[model samples]
Target: MGFSRRVGPPIVSAAVATLVLTNFAMVLLAERASHDGHLFASIWPIALTSTVAVVLVMSFLFRSIVEMGAELERREAEAQHQALHDQLTGLANRALLEDRLEQALCRYRRSGEQLALLILDLDRFKQVNDTLGHTAGDDMVRIVAERLRALLRDSDTVARIGGDEFAIIQARPRGEADVRSLCERIIETVGEPYRLGEREARVGVSIGAVFAGPDIATATDLLRKADITMYRAKAAGRHCFRIFTEAMDADVQRRDQIETILRAELAAGGGPELHFQPVIGGDGKIASVEGLMRWDQAVVGPIAPAEIVPVAEECGLIEQLGYNLVRQACALARRFPDLSISINLSPVQFRTMDFPAVLRRLVEGEGVPCSQLELEVTEQLFIDHGPLCEPALQALREAGFRICLDDFGTGYSSLSCLRRFPVDKVKLDHSFVDLAARDQSIALIRAAVTLGHAMNMEVIAEGISCEAEEQIALEAGCDGLQGHLYARAMPADQLQAWLAEAGKARISDAA
Candidate 1:
């Protein structure tokens, strides 16, 4: 490769001709033709050396450029690979899966075929991380991903879209049965124990499956459907899956409407309608009133107490609702100046820190006497007896706040509760008072009153109706009673009018 010619002399014709010219120049200058042969040969050698050097440098430069380009390409490829995949499980990430799903959706849309999306989330994963440590949890996640991959076909895509969250796109699922079958397989696969290091861990999955076709408009809608189904799967029980249904959508809509209204009510200074159920004394005196809260929306008819109360507790609105109701009742009492008002407090309120201080502040600010304000707590409000409840009750009682057990005999340790709590009165649950005349019921009522008297607490029997029940409660040592027998829940104006009537009756008797 260095030379492709046969050299006949010191140089080829071009180099020799250059030498001949140099020699002729010497002759023409009247110099001897014997001019130095060494110098002539040297001229040809220098030119040849220059050509070879240039070629060698260019060859080295070309090799360096090739190696540099290859190194850059490798880095870019590695980054691209990492971006599309999960680092821990080596599974495709949500982004890549979404892209692929969009492609498949487009194909299905054109072909008019059925496609399915399944999203699965681990149940109580936080518990696993808390009890077993994150290392074990991580290993379990990897094991789950691997097992899920094993259950799927090559055409299907399984991705770890989030932490302890996995998703699958089953292209052309046969039907609901196919989707259910895959769900079962996934559950069983993940349900198996994972051995990571010395720890054996177990976790369950809740899966939501959506069946749709070209009619599916958006990937967002598909995700929402799957997520809602996943929650349903959770509500049903873990380690299971549910198909998307219209009923579920309605349930979700109902919940959303409730949430929106609740937020609005709390923000807009309360649209809550307060109803007062009369708590009449044994002798028909207007004893006091129990405040009940009801909500009726423009779209949602009369909201049930069962629905609102639990939802409020779950959303941490119970504290606000309870406080607001208490404040409202206090304001109403200021109007009468003598009427006592009772506000029902849920267990959630008793457990909240600073609740007592907050309640006291509201009462004192409204100029409502603790005697005129009765704090009605349920039978089991003191469970666990956390400091939050302990000081609140004692402090309220010390401030002359009347404490009453709202639903007696409904929880364990009912007898002990009368003795233990700083309650001033015990309200026999409606169930017992509703039929107190019966043998067993009458005995229980009598026994409850005896217990209340022994604990030095007043007994207020609720749900009284007949004259017989009223006489029985009076004999049982119950100091007060409530029900339709004496008075029913009425409007504020009606209650005031009744109070005025009772006042006149008392004055006429004195005369």
Candidate 2:
């Protein structure tokens, strides 16, 4: 249309000019013929013939120009359409969706109709990308987009906002029920299996929804609120939808606060402290001490590891935190030459390609022998991270550091991990110790101990909080015991004093 508007006038003017020039020439010829005494009938006929021929030629030229303009307009329209739509899925792009959302809001304002915006993010989408490559990931996105479009009304707008994310503008929804039912349908459709070439891919969507009301003023606000709601759904669990709520906003604010505080504390070099929990050998001596992080905030007081660790991981502070703890633990271990130190490894740390080198540098700088340092990793590392974790673990083992599989028997592939990795010790999770009174639990623990021994690995029963639990662990033939029944995690000075007393006790018993 734009092209035609710009070029149509010039073509029409050229045709008109040619016709006018032909008319003027005919008039001149008639005058000359009259002056030369030619017959008026013959002159008139010649003039008429010339005028008709010029008019026909002009008409043909005009029609050709009009057709050219029309073709240009058609191509321009196709280009515009392509620009506003996703090339992969043919869904509306963000720009088009935003424009449509604004239009929808305007209609709602005039007619008092309700409009709902839903933002969806696919769950575990990265797994597909990591495992199957981006081509498969694109295929999955295309499949999901088709499913979403099929589930929506013609009046509704579904868009691919970005990778693994989509948005929908639902026009004139009846109420919450209507919005929720649409969301449910979208989730169900997306949850269905998709065949990407030879592989079967599956993923679920988390949806956040917001409706036009007193709170929503523009497309941006609607989209932001819906996004917040969608994250809440993800937190609740994927394959679900959540409506925007005031409480969710508060939770987001609190998390932001926590992350800010953590960053500030770490920057100031006054973050979580490293404490040691004694891991006693079966012969009743402190064989090694496990380093535990303790965060005592001035505002929140003492935070649990469960709460603090996730915050660190989410905010990308886990690697620094883990490294700092390891360095400090190594420095502290130097104070007691015979005491080996164990520190927990976060999955974030293992994900780093240079984590082994980083650990070596920290230990070497602290003047602690690598053999005296034990790195503990949960079974989830193998299950969640898979092959990416192998090189880091292997590198650390090659550096002369012992690797302990923490919370063993808690994961599905624990035995596989044992077979694949060079693990020095296996720490039985507390659940088994708690349920040791049951015959089956004891049998499981005993089997784990026997397997550990057969593999030439030490087996430690953790969370031995009672004498009965200790006795059960001993009976199960665990090489070590660790829990509150022995001693709580203590500060450096306290742990040092306790280690001295235990050493003396061992020497006296030998004497």
Candidate 3:
């Protein structure tokens, strides 16, 4: 409407000039016909002057109208583009990407050229922002977009669809080189670190690609396939791209179903409940049991805890799960005087501000020695912030809780890391214990023991099954053992019976 009004003045001026020009042309012709006298001379001069003025006005008016319209059209186009694009990156938004994708699919059916889309998410963007404020984060996004744009051809399109998410669409990528080259270029470009205010921040892109020529009919199907591949790319350890596959989609669907069930179970009062795995004493007695949360769906038999526990963590239900599990474990931790029950800590829990105080209150309120209650945490936790892991561990330690490094060999564990991290016990990964000797498992165990002894931490062997495995672990300098052969994980209600059996066996052995 604004443009329509702005154009009105130019159109009217053009029309007026055209009318005046026609009148002047007639006057000039009439003057040419008149021969002599003052009237002829005066009329001819006036007509000549009028004719020149009319021609000049008409030419100027015509040019102005054309120029205004073109400028208006260009302005409108730019405005529309800005509305659908991310401001910082000038990439099409999620909404525009989906709309254009549907159109692309329709066009692909008419001409059998391939249409492919790659979804890219910036890895560690949150970490960068958290460590170095939002200003640096914004600069990183701009830098990444510039690098990504350099990798693309004029025919291809790249869009910023999320905070750190980007979408690239190739209208007709028939050649293998076209597709591979584009992906490779993007990978190389995004892998470079952008020097944002002297931080040398590196932003890696994880891309999930999908191809739909004439085969795919539905937009949802195409997007779902791409999304599944993106999840696979993220899971396969980030900083790379993965092409979509049928199996990946199936795995995604299965996981979605599992997530649905897990949420349902949580809604229905957190299903099947928890069990405890006993951590034996230095003298081979029922010491403390580590709490293990399990799930048994009505339709599925005994769902593995590892699967749903992560789902809980991903869905922000981890805090709730942790609180509930810790409460239950603490309640039981109160019962056994000679025993100290341990709880597994999630990485999210370690980042919470009030976690340490909450833990302190739980231990103090229950009159349990915090040292008796060991916290089993994975080695991967150290990859994050020093400040984040600090308050939680320190508060627990100060409150007399002993922290154990759970799953020792599974993550970025070095000799230096072992010494630097404050820990009371080291639980050798069950992988090494399961094999024992064939695969240098004993050597690794010995090294871990040496490291633990050097650091003054108690060494515990996880899943020590046979007599030979237990003896091997002992000789490797393990202080305690746990496995199916020792005793299976049991509910708190059954802990009394297990304790009685363990106590009787201990008495008999002593005799």
Candidate 4:
């Protein structure tokens, strides 16, 4: 195309000039020959032949130029389309979507009619990508795009703004109800299974929507608010939608503050500090100490693990946080060689492909025996991850780290998980101990303890806070009891002091 553009014009100009000159020379020759009177008819025939030949050559040259121009036009149109559309899903790209949104916003301001902008992020998309490969993930995304196109009005715009992210512009939304209805349809349609070659994939969408109004002054504002709302939807447990509110802005700002503080804390060498609580064995001795993460920042007062973990996970600091805990546990393990140091594991940490190997390296690097570490995980980890957790758990067990199922019996499939997973202990959820007065609760506790014993696993009752609760747990045949009843969680140095005191008491009794 470049060559033709540069060379074709000059060549065509030269050809035209030559054609004119040749015709003029033939006309002059014919006129001069006609003056001779004897050769007039012959000269006319020769002149007509010369003129026809020149016209034929110029016509072919002009046709070639026209065809080249058409080809260039077609290619330019294609390039423009490609630039404005997603190559994979063929939906509008972010730039085009924003341009359209800005146009819609202008019309909205003029007409005072509401338009809606929605941002959608696919949940579990990464797991699909990691497990099934990008090809299948792409197929799933395209299927989602098709469903979105089908579910919306022809006037609506659907755009693929990022990997596993989409945006929708509802140009003529009647009201908030209309936006909600659209979101519901999108969630239902996109959640349906996608068949990608031999494999089937499933994903859910979290949507955030913002309506055009006084608050939304520009397209960028609308998109930003919609994205924040989408995150709120995800936090509420995906496959749902949330509308923007002033209150949501406050929450987002607070989260941003937390993220900034956390990063600074981590950069300074650590974020959350570890506190240890004793787990008293049935034999009347301290069996192990569970490492509890504590963050008492001056700015936030005291942030619970429940609050910190979600933020860490969202900000891509979960793996780093988990490793921090492991290193702390390892250091503590070295300090108290005889006692196992248990730490809770997040589902995100467990599902990482390199989790087992990385964990082995971290533990070995610290020179702590794997047996001195017990990893606590909620049953929900296995329930959510299923077969993916098996090899990781097996690898950890082979490396001699004990696996404890935290918050046991809360999930419907706890018993099933016990049968399948390589769990060495079950920590009775606090709810059972809290309701120890109920006959059903006592029976369930006893049954859990009995089943655990039958399976040759230890059953530990957590959250015991009173003498009565401890007695109940003991009578229920728990192998261990932990909670405020024994001792509140304390710093590692304080726990060392407590352990030393307990050792002296034991020595006095032996004497």
Residue pairs of candidate 2 with colliding backbone atoms: 208-230
lDDT tens digits, residues 318-423, model 1? 8777877887888788997877888788888877677777788888889887778888888667765644676789988887788888878888878666656688
lDDT of candidate 4 at residue 399, scale 0 to 100: 91
lDDT by residue (tens digit), candidate 2, 1-511: 4565577667767866776687667667677768664655455676677768776776677677778878888898899999999999999999999999989888888888788999999999999999999999998998898888888899999999999999998888899999999989988889998898898988999999988877678888888788889988998988899998878777667677778888998888778888898888878777889999898889868877887788899889998788778878877878887889998988877777888998898898899889999999998889888788888888888999999999998889988999998899999998887552567667879999989999999999999877778777888889988888867889999987877766434311311
lDDT of 4 at 297: 91
Lowest lDDT 10-mer window, candidate 3? 502-511
What's the distance in Å from true for residue 383, model 1?
Answer: 7.6
- Deviation in Å, model 4, residue 396 alpha carbon: 4.2
Ranking by TM-score: 2, 3, 4, 1
Which is the winner by lDDT between candidate 2 and candidate 3?
2
Ranking by lDDT: 4, 2, 1, 3
Which has the better lDDT: candidate 2, or candidate 4? Answer: 4
How big is the positional error of residue 417 in model 3, measured in Å on the Cα after superposition?
4.4
Instruction: Kindly indicate the candidate among 2 and 4 with the higher TM-score.
Output: 2
lDDT of 3 by residue, 27-78 (tens): 6666677665455566666666776776677667766766786788889999
- RMSD, every candidate, angstroms: 9.3, 4.8, 6.0, 5.7
